[model samples]
Target: MEFRCIQDCSQCCIEREYYPSKKFGKIGVLILPEEKERIEQLAKINGLKISILPRIGISEEENSNPTKILAYQLMGIEPNGNTCPFLDTETSDKSPHGGFPCKIYNKRPLACMTYPLIESEPITLD
Candidate 1:
């Protein structure tokens, strides 16, 4: 079955407070080694700057700061949210899904290509 997103909704783009407890890490995703170079090149070609997130797996060490939890430096990360930088927000209202479309949908990073993947209990997406 095909899964489609709800209209006028971008809840998945938001961030979650990732703690060290349980299955957790930063709200941002990690970019695959294979996709990293491609995304970086594309960002440069398009004049877009992206943020880098470090890799931080679950820590058995005590007093670990979740705030500093790292991951494999993701590309296409939005500053204030988990949404990809290539997401076309302004054109959202005009789209059938009413969801902001990706500017580089065809060539988006592996992470952006897979979204709303439920881990644990399923929650409502705004």
Candidate 2:
């Protein structure tokens, strides 16, 4: 099977809410073992602030915290909907499709990398 994100469609990122972990709050994300060092190095070199989220911040009590974790939700969906802050719907005049762009494309979390793949450690049969 082929895995590829549809062109110009960040629907998944816009569909759910994401949150960073308390330990690495505002430091980007709780990257996987393989992604840790590279992301850190990038942040240091580029002077970029990184943060981590637990379970993509899909929680009811994300708010009411002292740290004031940045809250972002997709817009125009059912139940509770809001657009991700990172999703810039604005594009440049010279560009063809002007809209929200991912600020951290390179350092995006594993979730973004393995979107269509669901890896299971052990095979299960029911």
Candidate 3:
């Protein structure tokens, strides 16, 4: 199956929620291996005090709960079924001149980067 990633579509945010990152909890954003200082600097500039929690995922144990997983695919729910705070439906401004913006674009997780390319080769993988 060929999966063409979403074109500027943040649909994953539809079902992906975030939490206080285990390590970057105080920065309001999760920190990737190389994004620490950049994210920290950005947070400082924006005055955001949030942590970067690991993005949650559905597991085999939860396979029986299609509703739960479906929620993840449709609502970005937390393990406890809470909606993601970063999701803003009214902000899509994908203009040709550069207006569409994600509030957390820089701090977005690997999952966000790997969208639509789910089975790509490791080299192409996010």
Candidate 4:
């Protein structure tokens, strides 16, 4: 299915309607060490808050293979879960085709760069 971005469809960035103009958005992306500095700095400039995923490498369940635990930074959550802080929640003239434009579109992470396109990809649930 060809996923087209519809106008006025803030479904992806309207998860937090209570506080429409939030600065610290919780993303579901797992950032890498190499991307930490860049993403953090940019996110800060855009008024977005970053959170560390798996904050710790050592957990109760994964005590055997500690390496499995990863420390990645994220901006938003599982697609519709959290509204991206970079997104212009205040839908107005700036919003295009009804969707909010990313404040850092050019520097968006790999997860967002390959959005919807991967939506159709097969999911392996082991």
Clash count for candidate 4 is: 8
lDDT of each: 0.56, 0.44, 0.43, 0.56
Ranking by lDDT: 1, 4, 2, 3
Across 3-110, the per-residue lDDT of candidate 1 in tens digits comes to 665533444444443545535444555566566678778778777787655565455567775554434655335433356565556572545655675556567655
Query: Which residue pairs show backbone clashes in model 1?
Result: 54-70, 54-71, 55-70, 55-71, 56-70, 56-71
Model 2: residue 37 alpha-carbon error in angstroms: 2.7
Q: List TM-score per model, in order.
A: 0.57, 0.38, 0.37, 0.55
Local accuracy of candidate 4 as per-residue lDDT tens digits, 65-86:
5565455645354344376666
Candidate 1's C-alpha runs over 4 A off are 1-26, 57-79, 121-126
Greater-TM-score candidate between 1 and 2: 1
lDDT of 2 at 10: 58
Question: Least accurate stretch of 10 residues (summed lDDT) in model 1?
Answer: 7-16
lDDT of 2 by residue, 15-96 (tens): 4432243332222222554555665576566565444232232335655443332332122222223343333455542223
- Judged by TM-score, which candidate is best? 1
Stretches of model 3 off by over 4 angstroms after superposition: 17-31, 53-100, 104-108, 116-126
Model 1 earns a TM-score of 0.57
